[model samples]
Target: MDVGDLLGGNAWSYVGGTLLVLWALVWLYRDGLQVDAVADKYVLVTGCDSGFGNLLCKNLDVRGFHVLAACLTEKGADDLRMAAGPRLKTVLLDVSSRDSVQKALEWTTKEVGEAGLWGVVNNAGRSLPMGPSEWMKVEDFHSTLDVNMNGVIAVTMSFLPLIKKARGRIVNVASVLGRVAANGGGYCISKFAVEAFSDCLRRDIHYFGINVSIIEPGFFKTAVTSLEPLEKELQRLWEQLSPEVQASYGDKYLDKYIKVQRLIMNAICDTDISKVTGCMEHALTAAHPRARYSPGWDAKLLWIPLSYMPSCVVDMGLKLVLPRPSKSV
Candidate 1:
């Protein structure tokens, strides 16, 4: 047979084979192991004031788990209490503070009693002053790291004994930024640290039957990704820069950056955050949970693939899309 005939005839075969493989993988993934006595399980979720933490607490409560929803403020706790059922309890927790984490641990220990904790969801995070690296102060990076990275470690370490006793799950809320360094700031660095920490923890505790799952979600309409707040923060950071620095990145650059940010948020951010919380739910309840879950179409299709691409290729693509600084080198 000629080259053209052979190529045309085999194309269909290749496509069919790929589809069959994907179907089989999906089937296996969906057919998770059985979970027993879900009602008896106790789960702790941080940052329950809003977003995925709040929704997950409600969902797990409805599913009959004893949910301990940790909020950063009294108002948040009260609001969560009103929304969740009677069985879902709320605690005041600030993961960045050791004293707060200790108090939360004491409360959670008392609440769970001998049954122990079935899961701990580290979902508390912050993203601020997320402009170019040149505009950031050391303190800005430290502040984000304290809340996002250190907080996760403190909370996890505090709850390890309880989780180990139940041989349960640890669901760390990372980001697609963890895999891809698309943004400049502590948000991406903190997430990258979380991914590494989860991997190491998983391997270390696997022998004890403790499962570690990392959730890498793309842009979602949560308080963390709120456009108004982010824009204000960017402006504040820009204002703090020295006059020389400000002149280097002119007012026009800042304006263009804000416009681009608004456009991206409006165009790409997923309003339905349930896609992320669903992954968290499955990780906690499934008998055999996955090590990692990348929710949202953007995460699964775009960011994840881009993360694996060559650095030069990724950088070129980023340059095309990202706004150029006024005095870019």
Candidate 2:
């Protein structure tokens, strides 16, 4: 080849290599940057019963951070307190109840004192009333929304002063479902709300030297992903439906729905929950925390990608996977 042509090709290759090296170096710098004095920093994580919340409490405790774990049950609190180090404290908190949240706030205020709260992981959430939207009543919807959406709002609003005092991080556990709708219940709706709230909160609180990170995990083997309770809830809703409604869907619909749900859960649910808690830890510890963290492979590979696709394409795919009603034209 002529010298000019060879030089031109090599020049583009050299430029590409330079750009790639710069990007990797920047990523490593951000990844390595962590906050100072982790042992003194106080971080409160909600929903520390038996899932991401529980795992995160232990993970942070091991890293020498002062961890405040909030569980809905006394047993859960006791279990966690037993497992964690002396610096890890547990509180009984039912996020849906105002009184419970208020009590927890007072306790946290006393614990953090002048040092302020470093991080707050709004992780408590429930997934139920999850079948077809028509099968659920207002009360069923309320049950999920009360804990998943309102609970986040209540906890965040109540603790803003402490968070502001420290000018720290607020890590919220949203779901891939938040970005893409694959279900028909308040679970997805609630997460979508969380995503919106976090976006608004980050903008509002950036002046206080605070940052907000959203954790959007795919299906994981947590209490939230258990099929037994979901199956029971589906049966309960089916029984409650009117005769005409039941006839329209036919007897086979419920079974087919359950089967499809089971297949999807089995296929996609990642057993290693550490994938989620790891993201949570980085969000809490990293000096330059990411705006969003999607942990599981399904999150990165499927749900997140689907969220960015065209509505018609997503709708068509959903229609293909989801079971059709007997009454459908």
Q: Count the clashes in each prediction.
A: 0, 0
lDDT (CA) for every model shown? Answer: 0.93, 0.94
Q: Which consecutive 10 residues in model 1 have the weakest lDDT in total?
A: 26-35
Choose the strongest candidate by TM-score: 2
**What is the Å distance of residue 37 in model 2 from its true position?**
0.4
Q: Provide the RMSD of all predictions against the true structure, rounded to 1 decimal.
A: 3.3, 1.5
- After superposition, which runs of candidate 2 have C-alpha atoms over 4 Å from their true positions? 1-10
Looking at model 1, how many pairs of residues clash?
A: 0
Q: Tens digits of per-residue lDDT for model 1 on 135-254?
A: 899999999999999999999999999999898999999999999887788999999999999999999999999999999999999999898899998888888899999888776988
Q: Give the TM-score of candidate 2.
A: 0.96
lDDT digits (tens) for residues 114-154 of candidate 2:
98999999999999989899998999989999999999999
TM-score of 1: 0.92
All candidates: TM-score: 0.92, 0.96
Candidate topping lDDT:
2
